[model samples]
Target: MQVSNRIAIAWPLATTAMHERVDALRQGGEDVIDLSIAISHFPAPLPVRQAVAAALREPRLPYTAVGGAPELRAALAAKLRGENGIAATPAHVIATNGAKQAVYEALYVMTDPGERVIVLRPHWPAYAATARLLGLETVLVDQPDVIDAAFLATLPAARVLVVNNPHNPTGKVLTAGELAAVRDWLRATGTACLVDESYEKLVFDAVHLSLAACPDWEALGIVTVFSASQSHAMMGWRAGFAVAPQAWVSAMSTLQGPITAAVPALTQVAAAAAFGIGAVSELLADYRVRRDMVVALFAPVAWAAVAAPAAGPYLWCDIRALTFDTQGFAELLLQRYRVALMPGEALGCPGFIRIGFIADDEATLRRGVGAIITLGDSMARAAGGHACSA
Candidate 1:
């Protein structure tokens, strides 16, 4: 059997690879402390669960339109306009099965083959995969906590400029001034700015401003993709939407029809309710406590350090001081210490490792950090290393 070249070019995701390693370690009687995946440690909000329950109790099990129920889109549109100051109507919003699917649809609708799109790194891995799958070329750029204006000017005019704020894995957020600059810069070059605010609700210590709010932004192609999956802790609910110009929304609606129909009616209803509640904030506070606790364990040691994430639930740490690459340290720690973390290379940052700050109990998280430090010290000492130099 023959598979396509796109599938062949894809790098198997690091998170899934770690899961297989974890299973092997577990069968060997090792106790594992997991920090690999990004699943929220909290349950869905009460209203959302109730909505799903209500829908499940119904007899229809019927299909919704490809763009989802009008009620959910209206609720989302109202929230976008009233709160975020983004000019979106129900006509410009579509609820797909999940945020990931929404992203894929937008990319497909907006892209022509071989078009160049700028994807800022250390990013979620899927962004690159999606580009490759569509035969679209991705120009990988690095904005280490937002680059200087001079450096950004060097890029060629692009078809689209992609960014993930309140970022995944690294959990960094771009400031308002920076966002405005990107909007202006991209618009001037005729590049559509696709600002992914999937982690928008995860912003803990900063304000998140959208490119859509920039002057004449809609006319210049500013698109924002979002989901209740992250905001409402509703991953399984698979409820997501994209906000853009009416034309783009119409394209997305058509593309999503057979690809991934509208999200379940109950999920969309619950997502509408999610917009009115603070379940996301309350849950973030809990995760923040875990983040602080985990960082505290590494704080005492000078050899290892965690750059406190501005948002979401991850700790992206530089571990190259102990080894040549992050995977060396991650693998040794996993084999001996039984703690799993995402290597930064997977997120496009070499020599760093990422730990999900809220994946485990506070006690377990603390212990895992300690194990990493201890194991790292030994490895660095034995290898005549860099990271564990105390």
Candidate 2:
């Protein structure tokens, strides 16, 4: 049997593929330290676990509405209004398996196959991959240090713009001014917006602001997606939801029904519990320490430049001085040093790599960093020796 032409050209997401490779090696008894993706060392918050426990005690779990149980939707609406400053109601909300589903459905409902979608460079892989799968043209622009009106003016008009707050890998949180500029640009261009706030609760120094928090969100056609995977350390739970106009939510729900009906009942329960708990201070504190430690470790190394991010669990390291073929560097590091990390090529920027410092214990994290430095130093030395001999 032959695969469909659409999927035949596509490969597994680089981030997930690398993590799976590490898993395979570990299962074979190899000691591989994985920093391929952000998988928190901490477990889900106490309340979420407790909520799932209580739900399990019920006699039976029945199917609810396609979007979510009424109660769950209502609770999520409250979360949007209170925490995110987005005025939402149950009709404006739809529960999803995770943020990825929300993103796919939003793009599907918001644009036609031939329409264009604007994505910033060094984006989460799914944004481009999903757009491609939908047969939509993806316009990738280099993300600027600041997103002001002048910068937004340079972008071409498109059907949709994807925004990631407390962004992945880089952890650049959009400032209020930047968000206002984007909102104005959307209003001016008549382009819809999809904002992913999966890392909202992981902010270290900067504040995470929702793009759709303004009064004109509904008119602007902005859909905001949230996930408990990173915020609550509920990666396996796959609990997430989206806030959109009622009609868009209805359309997304119609689409979600056939693909994967309402999110699991227990997940809805866990989501409600997780979102209601607000910021997880303890988790934030731990991640901050780890982030600083990794940044400090890379400071003395001349070949790598790693900075402390204001938010999120990953550290972005630039090693262009050593080599631009980060894909090969990552592969060799995994094979020879038994450590795994995400190459910047996967995130649309070569000569860089993303290191997730939130997964293993302190010792393991230190060891992984040491291995990376050792490999990079060796490569630098070999290059120097070759140059002198020539």
Candidate 3:
């Protein structure tokens, strides 16, 4: 017997390798600064902590309803309705281990083996990888400098579209007009969308748009998935929920029952608490400051080009001037400077890198950015002289 062909598919390796290298360096007491994964350094809200502790002492630690505890689901539904302008009820929500699970489940329910799913570029690798895992082909559309009829024409044939708003890697928050265009396309094409709003509360520019909030979303088939992990700094808690039409939610609930049974009783309680008070404005302010700091720090890196992100906590840097592809650049940067940032190849784009600003404190950010800038200089000199490798 051999491993399943499905399991054998090649996933992104550069980012994972960088992570492992960072871990090894940390274990060896090296002063490595990690900017790869989008982990938050901010503290979780006080109420959430208290709730988790209280949940531990509750009498019944048994499995909960597959969707979630009714109170938690209802709380999330209320949050969605009020904040996202989506008309949702408890019956339309399905809680999962995290948005990661919710997204996978939605794709599983919607996709067939050889059908195509559309994904936007400079995206989270999981969106494409998961589609491939289910044997669904991924049709990638690079974020156009301008959306046009020609570009929009490329979308309709795909069975499902995966959208990450306040988009990952690039941190681009979609405008109202852009969201409207996508909504119109989906409605016209009869395509379904899996909307990942993981960073909804972290928007620093333009408002976040929820396709689920579109007036005719149920008619267009939208599945909006969200996580408490990013907003509340509850990464380890793995609490998330999805809002969709009642029938789709019901199917997800049933499909989810046997997978993990249900999200833990304790996690659900804590997440419910998190949703009750909401993402802290103080944390959002801090992240925005760091985002600005990172952009400012990279301003002098002559060999790198980056745009200030409009939302989320990343600076997407284009390093094509460095004379190496992203995989090589990431490996070399980690080895030479002890700086760990994600290669854009992991997100389906080469010659770019995503630097997450939220994980590092101000001092760490300064040092890491300085290292990258210095490395850029070295790379520039090498480009004019000789080939370089790490």
- Please provide TM-scores, in order, for all candidate models, with all chains considered together: 0.92, 0.98, 0.94
lDDT of 3 at 188: 80
- Weakest 10 consecutive residues of candidate 1 by summed lDDT: 381-390
Error at 381, model 2, angstroms: 0.6
Write one digit per residue (lDDT tens) for candidate 2, span 1-390: 999998986788998999899989989999999998889999999999999999999999999999999999999899899989999999999999999999999999999988999999889999999999999999999899899999999999899999989898799999999999999999999999999999999899998889999999999999999999988888999999999998999999999999999999999999999999988999999999899988888888888888789888899999998899999999999989999999999999999999999997999999999989888888989888221110
Local distance difference test scores for all models: 0.77, 0.92, 0.82
RMSD of each: 2.3, 2.5, 2.8
Q: Residue 72 in candidate 1 has what lDDT? A: 77
lDDT per residue (tens digit) for residues 39-110 in model 3: 788778989989888878878788779899888888988999899999889998988898879988899887
Residue lDDT tens for model 1, 1-390:
988887877766677688678878889888898887666767888887877788789888677777878777888888888767898889988887776787788888888989988888787777887888888989988866565467678777789888787788777778777776776687567888777887778777777766687547678887888877766777677777888888898999888776767777777777777776743667888877787777767775556668678787678787666554787778777778788988887878887788886655677877788888888777666777544322
Model 2 TM-score, all chains together: 0.98
Ranking by TM-score: 2, 3, 1
Better candidate number, 2 or 3, judged by lDDT = 2
Query: Looking at candidate 1, what is the lDDT of residue 75?
Result: 84
Clashes of each: 3, 0, 0
Task: Please list the residue runs of candidate 3 whose C-alpha ends up more than 4 Å from where it truly belongs after superposition.
Answer: 10-17, 146-150, 385-390
